[model samples]
Target: MKKDDNAFGVEEAADSPGFLLWQVTSLWQREIRKALEKYDLTHSQFVLLASTMWLMQQGEPVTQILLSAHSKIDPMTTSTVLRTLQTKGLLERKEHTTDTRAKTVALTTTGEKLARQAIKTVEQFDTDFFQALGSKLGDFNKKLRLLLQQ
Candidate 1:
């Protein structure tokens, strides 16, 4: 094959945004896994737990569907995770007062405490992980939000 005859449009892998994003995301998730080890929570569990606590604080009844949407996790996965959390004694699933088809989720006392603690740890990890971007972090976040909007 010719020196320039490769499948990639970019001359180098480093120039591909998707590739870079994959690499960075992998590294970030690895560290987050380590950070959450003490809490005995996987990243998904922490996300759902924290999200449930946050939504509850807003005085809105948080249902499984709502939590799934908020966390960007699919309904099936959300259900499975919720079941796991319930089994772990971290959360409770109850019939919604108004919706017969929907079940509301709430963190138990232990779950709430663990969620708060894990959130602090994850937030600190994020701060440190993204600190290299420094002042550009806001712009980076905005760009990410824009991508999400797409």
Candidate 2:
């Protein structure tokens, strides 16, 4: 009997765009994870924290629901992450002045410091990652934006 060639031998996967995308995403995520590990934050935590910090800097009183919408995070997960950040003294949650029932989030000094450092790391990683595409990055980003618009 002939050996199952595709099963045992390395096959050309040029046609597997989904697989390729998955592989690339995995690699990028791994690199980010490695970088963020030093800051004692997971990727989701960093994203939420950074987003909160940035939005807060614009002098807007932002709520958890608003953060969820902006960060594309689920409410429950955002709540959980915010709690963790609070415990770390990185963020604070207080009653929304205008909305008696809602809570507003603010980044503490520590959180702001961490976000600043993490931002440098993330920016460097993004620059290096996207540099491979050179001028093609704009086109690639545009295409991705188009797809995401759907």
Cα lDDT over the full model 1: 0.96
- Clashing pairs for predicted structure model 2, backbone only: none
lDDT for each candidate structure: 0.96, 0.90
What digit string (tens of lDDT, one per residue) describes model 2 on residues 11-78?
Answer: 55744666778899999999999989999999989999999988987899979999999988999999
Cα lDDT tens digits for candidate 1, 1-150: 674677987778998899999999999999999999999999999999999999999999999999999999999999999999999999999999999999999999999999999999999999999999999999999999998998
Best by TM-score: 1
Per-model TM-score, in order, reads 0.96, 0.86
Candidate 2 wrongly placed segments (more than 4 Å): 1-13
Model 2 deviation from the true structure expressed as Cα RMSD, one decimal place: 3.8
